[model samples]
Target chain A: MGALPELSVDIGGLKIKNPVIAASGTFGYGDELAPFYDPSLLGAIIVKGLSLRPMPGNPPPRIVETPCGLLNAIGLANIGIEAFVGEKLPSLATIKAPIITNIYGHTIEDYAEMARRIEGVKGIAAVEVNISCPNVEQGGMAFGRDPDSAARVADRVVENTTKPVIVKLTPNVTDIGLIAKAVEAAGAQSISVTNTFLGMAVDVATRRPKLANMVGGLSGPAIKPMALYLVHEVVKAVRIPVIGLGGIMDYHDALEFLLVGARAIQVGTANLVNPKAAIEIVNGLTDFCLREKIKDINEIIGALETKGEDHEKKGDRKDKSKANF
Target chain B: MDKSRYPMVEEVVSIGFNREIGKDTFLMGFPCVALTSRAKPGQFLMIQVDRQAKDPLLRRPFSIHGVLDSNRLMILYKVVGKGTALLSALREGDTISAIGPLGNGFTLPGPGERALLVAGGMGIAPLFFLTQVLTRAQNHSVKMFLGFPTSQDVVLIDQLKGLGVDLSLTTEDGSLGIKGLVTDLWDQTLSQESTQKPVTYACGPASMLKEIAQKAIARNLRCYVCLEGYMGCGLGICQGCAAKAAGSKDKPYYYVCQDGPVFSAEMIDWEVM
Candidate 1:
């Protein structure tokens, strides 16, 4: 009846027009994707991972399709930080969306240098610290293993960059809550819960791994439920915002993350399936708000209500376990 | 090429013809004016055949085989897996969602220069369109060498035969023209040619392309090779179809969908790639 729902979201101070941001790696430097639709229409665009210097990434057969998931060991392939600021940034300036460049490094200085270079960029909304790449020899999953290393990596990037820092955590960790708290303490403005899960698929015919890197990060619809759980877990553990991702295909999937406690959602593997998936989700969210007669889309964020019966069942289960002991 | 000038079109196109052309190979023609008119030889389309299903969530990538007219386009394919098998089952008039005129097409050989095209199996699809494009120029001398497993797997011979170019075919089992690989015929053609170092264009399996590359290198000739991989989004954003381009000192991985499904033969470091 009125105009429409407010789709704008501020993830721990990084403001975007909507809650639908294109996930890194899936959406390049917002160049190839521009033909499908104007990326500025999206909430934000996270460019491919970047290092201090240009990295060649892994060998061929880097991406393999399996079931509902995609295994990619792109090994943080990028043109380096200097090239981005020099060449790619000028082109990305045309898009109206906020740009959040994803940075990965082998050492803390590597991360700081990338962030420091990105700090002066005009259009960048924030810097997403990638500490979950499983394909690389140094950094990646190794940094996310311990809380201290993860915190230090986060602290270093934040110290160098004037813009807000969003740490993207890995799903391989045992306690994602502890890692979330660690990054928060290190001044990470926000955390994107659950990067791709480390998984390996083998070809029966070849008797070798699907990805040349031996293992790759798994993203797509298969990991959505697990990613959602991690997002909710981190949401309860930290005061900062949580950007939920991993396997989000449509608006309903995005809505679930928002209701469970995510401030915003990202579409990763779905981009491979549908080039316009992120923008389509943005449109779908608007349609959902219109149908539900909600004024602000943010009202749906962390709105999960606990029924008394469900709480009683949880209490009863705990009491029964104690009684048996 | 500015890709936006081609204009991407996604619509349900009616199939004009769908029939078995060769062993495991079929040609499906659809009528879509917007896409057919703008499509170049090497460009591909992402077709969604099983519209009702989600298990095969991503659309299948098919290179533009040949343009029938301003309103119709053909996609020639072989049934390799679940996606193509699904594509083969469609009958005439069945509508499929297609996104196209995507990716940069092949760079045509210069005028007065001789052109050599080598293709294997279903890889003949794009080369067929390229032959027609080259013929229209009416200046360059065109020669084609196609390879198939046997006589049964051979396809589009009649169409290629009428093109007025020097066309040849080969089969592995000696059921066709020559009793060896297409490269054998290519070698023979080069040995007894009067044309001054003709540029070569090719499409086929990896092994065949590698073989062709070695032959091209031995002769010190430049070749353009079109490659295919497990592509997710043919739009290049996915970075799924990445082919390692051998740079001078910094060998960077180029997105095959973006940088090229078609590239200079020597640019790709086949050994490590």
Candidate 2:
């Protein structure tokens, strides 16, 4: 009868109703999915990737289904940052949850321009820097792949935007912990680890690629294990909160991230499969807390039990991540 | 005006029937109230083949074929790939975890307007549902042009024949009614029939729709089309089904799953799409 459980959390100082955010690219500005359920019911919503100018995106067959996952080479298709701030921000204002806009660019300047433009925007609680889209031909994963380049992009956005900045990291890099440390040192308020892995699929009979572009970012449950390791390493390497995402399907997956030290979790590919997934995760997490007699969801954060025999294994892993840092 | 349409509804509905209507093509019926009651023509449903499968993680999107009652409807699908093949294994009385009535439906004809429905291959699903909406209207002058590769490739004839429409069927191999492409039949209709320049509504291969859009543009006729694309989410989130805007220099793309499964003929940019 009473309030079930406290599920809200703050990321880089932005308060959310819960710890489940609809990840960028999966929740298209929240306007389309708003019909199915009030997106405000979730912790927050991150709109799709936007740039300085509107992108026409890649050609047809942008997405192809892989075993337990999807490969997409959409090339960061979006209404430019100006159109989004001008046309889309107003509608999202009426919603109760914080709106985190996902911004991408072909260059560091592009990221800073978008950041500067949205600096004083009323509704957007934070700006998520997407420097890790592997599908695009240029500028997306380029910056995130190198520590120096990632630091430059993060520093530019951090300096330009008064609103908090969450750098969205890609898993395609060799050592994500390096990029996390670089961004954190550059003053990024928080980190969203990780983005999709670069992969491709083809129809062997026709001798044609499944997607129009030869390669794309792979997402879904297939990449979760790899993503969990990356998140855990990044959480261990950096002091900033890690917003975990990359095939989080349900509350159990969300719980996994929180336990691994993610301040919150973003529902990405799962939103494509189920529009209400973020809300379901929020509701399910409350149910889990109720059943377990846990009153505070914060207790679940970094709750991974690494006792006795497991200490050596996790400690060795930490040492490796430290080397990357 | 129609029953209030919902963009997304999830339910495990019992398949009242599942059978082959044509070669490698089948129809499955589901009696789910949440969908059928609010269903509109041109809307689609995403059938999750194996909820446990990850490779083909996305649901196979199927257009609503027809509304049988307040709680029953059917999905017409062709077994082309992995998802549909997984769907084909289901039998009558089996339960399907599906979500629908997604996307913007076909805009119904006005009081004074006559309807022209063009379909190609399995794209006939949404148009077939439009015929049902037209059948119940006062202005019932519905002309249909259905195109298939050959006679053996055709389906939905017996059911469509019952609609009392001015039906025209075409096959590329001359194995059926008029010979040549479906566009040939459309050209013939334009030149032959003189029914106050009927408003055109088409759902089919991109080529056929483009042909109609071009012809509609030349003749100055109102046209609407439903486009099919490889989609991740039948909902608009993935942007996987983005259609290149045709004939426009300003805006370049339209989200096919949301902005339209149905679009005005001239509004799309065909050159790049």
Candidate 3:
């Protein structure tokens, strides 16, 4: 009977209408999903990762399906930053929602240059520095695996551009909390916790790897639990907002991430499986708020309860397990 | 690549029938007037086999096999992997989510030009629809060459026979019309006919398509081939299905889901495919 629950949220200073974002790589250049649903319905649209020059990507067999997961070695294929700004940004800027440009590079200079190129772009709301793509051989996961390099990449992007910088992190690291804190200190506005995990698959009959690159980045529901734990740790470690994403398929999965102190959530592989997934989650969040009689969706963010003694002991047990590692 | 030409439809359509036409192959039909009315010959459908499970995370892509009764759309698929095996178990009256009329279909042949339809094994799926369209047009003489691994693999014979085209069949083990690859029949057709302006349209394995493309190029013929690739989203968003472009150094890849499932043979680089 009352007005619809307010779903708007802020990722650092970049304000979006909702918390459900279409992750990079899965949602192309914001035009692919236009046939399925309106692109402006979501909180933000992040195009595929771009580079200094057009990248041809890896060879055939770039993707393979695993058990409730997908392994892809696409190698950060894009039409370069110039092409995106010239060809794609014009149409994308017309959309109502914020458009975030996702950029990756083969070097620190490449990352800084990419930030400089999109500096005063009219349509772009933010820049997501991809220092965590495991598919590429250089400058991708290489920059995110260590605290020093991750902070350096984040610091350079922050210095080159006035746009809000959200450094996306990799899960294939020794201590994700340490890297999260490092980037926050280096002037990143927010952090998107966890990119695809490094994985591989083999064909038994041919005795060959399923992917041409031999190893690829694993995503989808298979990595949800691990990604959620990593998001929880990063949210606790840093004061900046955290965007949680890993195999988030539906509104229930989105709720799981938001409850764990994430300011927003990204739907990656789910976008590939179902084109209208982000919109559906947005609708689901509204319905959930209406049914629960919540005034605003922010009431649900970081609202997880850990008051019971049993929960505290379980946290202690996890801490002990981490010490064992 | 001009997506506005064919507006995509995502719907939950009920299955009209799901039956086996041959060994490990199926012919499934669903009443989807939206798809049947807008779909072209070479466009494809991304069908979600199991909506409840996440094991097969992505939808499986199948070429639009044919249309029946002007309301029902068909998909001819062979059981080769886990996805196909799951699809084979689906029965009549059950609902499956599908998005379609996706990708660019085969370009229609010009008037008075002879249409050469080639199929290898299960590659006959889309060409069957092309044959139907071509046969109904005026001044378009249609000739088909179908090749299978064995007689057991041969399918749609009774239906294809009713289409009223000059059809030839071949098998590797000599279990059918002639014992040889389908290219041999194609070669004979090309060598035997010199007067008619022939346009080639083919779908099949890479090796077969490459051979046909090479021969068609040598004769300076306008040839179009429908290709298959492992796709995450049949909507060009995934960019998973990358195919090499012919003589192109600047832009090296063409996504099979967008640039084509059907492409001019001259547009692709055969050496790297």
lDDT per residue for candidate 3 within B104-178, as digits (tens), equals 999998888889999999899999999988887757989999999999999988898898888999999999889
TM-score between candidate 2 and the true structure: 0.90
Note the DockQ of each predicted structure.
0.44, 0.53, 0.58
Interface RMSD (Cα, Å) for model 1: 3.2
Question: What is the alpha-carbon lDDT for the whole of candidate 2?
Answer: 0.86
Tens-place lDDT digits, model 2, residues A57-144:
8887899888888889988888888888888888777678888999988999989899999998888899999989998888989999
| DockQ leader | 3
Q: Could you tell which candidate, 2 or 3, scores higher by DockQ? A: 3
Docking class of 3: medium
Interface RMSD of each: 3.2, 3.6, 2.9
TM-score, model 3 to reference: 0.96
Candidate 1, B1-273: lDDT as tens digits: 244554786767988888988888899998888888889999889888855455667788889998886788999999988878988998888889898877778999888889999999888989999998898789989999999989999998889988777888899998988878998788788888846898889999899898888789778998989888667778766666778677666656777877788988887878864
Residue A231 C-alpha lDDT in model 2: 92
lDDT of 1 by residue, A1-325 (tens): 7898999989977888899998988898876666667777999989988888888887768887777778888788788888888888898777888888999989988898888888777888899999988889999778887899999999999999889999999999899999999999999999998799988999999999988888898888878999999999999999999999989988888988999999999888787777778888999899888877778989999987666568778888668635532
TM-score of each: 0.93, 0.90, 0.96
